[model samples]
Target: MISRGSIVVMAIGGALLIISIAHHSQEWMRVASRLGPIISVILDGGLAISLISAGWWLRKQQTTLTPDE
Candidate 1:
C-alpha cells in the first residue's frame, strides 16, 4: 500500500516539475540564467527528479515488504 508521506513527496515533486517547466519562459529563463548553470540544473532537474524517485522507491519497498495475504 502507498503511504501518505510518499504521496505528499510525489505531489511536491510533481509541483516542482511543473514549476521547472514554467520557469523556462522568457522572463523566468532570464532570471534562472543569471543564477548560473550548476544551480539551475540542480534546482530545476535534480531536486524534482530525486523527490519523485524517492517517493516511488518508498512505495515499491513498502509493497515488496508486505506479506502476501
Candidate 2:
C-alpha cells in the first residue's frame, strides 16, 4: 500500500539519518567531548527514529486515503 511519495519520504529520511549520524559522531569526537558518548548517541537515535516514523506514518496515511481494489 505504499505510495511513491512515501517511498521518497522514507529514502530522504534514511539519507538524512545517515548524514546526521556521521556529522554528530565527528562532532562528538572533536567538539563535544564534554557531552560524552551517551548524549550524542541518544540525540542521533531520537532524530533517526522520528524521521523514519514520520515517513512510515505518511505512507500509512496515503494508503488509507486511496480507494481499495
Candidate 3:
C-alpha cells in the first residue's frame, strides 16, 4: 500500500509539473519577463521525475501493507 505522504507528494508534483509546462509554453515572458522560461522547464522536468520515482516506490511497497501479520 502507498503511504499517505506519497499520495500528497505525487499530487503536489503533478500540479507543479502542470504549472511549469504552462509557464514554459506561454509567451508572457516576452511581454513582461520575471523569472524566465528556463526555470519553468527545469522545474517541470524535476517534478515529473520525482512523481515517477515516488510512484515506483509506492508500487514496490505494495506487498508490505498489512494490519495483522
Number of the top-ranking candidate, with lDDT as the measure: 1
Stretches of candidate 1 exceeding 4 Å from the true structure = 28-43, 67-69
Clashes in model 2: which pairs?
none
Query: Best by TM-score, which number?
Result: 1
Model 1 lDDT tens row, 1-69: 678988888889989977876665444556635556446656687789999999998888887885769
Q: What do the candidate models score in CA lDDT, each in turn?
A: 0.76, 0.75, 0.71
Models 1 onward score TM values of 0.67, 0.64, 0.54
Over the full model, what C-alpha lDDT does candidate 2 score relative to the true structure? 0.75
Error of 2 at 33 (Å): 2.3
Ranking by TM-score: 1, 2, 3
Better of 1 and 3 by TM-score: 1
Q: Give the range where candidate 1 is weakest over 10 consecutive residues by summed lDDT.
A: 24-33
> Model 3 scores what on Cα lDDT?
0.71
| Order of models, best lDDT first | 1, 2, 3
Task: Quote the positional error of residue 54 for candidate 2 in Å.
Answer: 1.6
1-69, model 2: which lDDT tens digit per residue?
A: 677887777787788778777877777678736575457667776777687888899888887795759
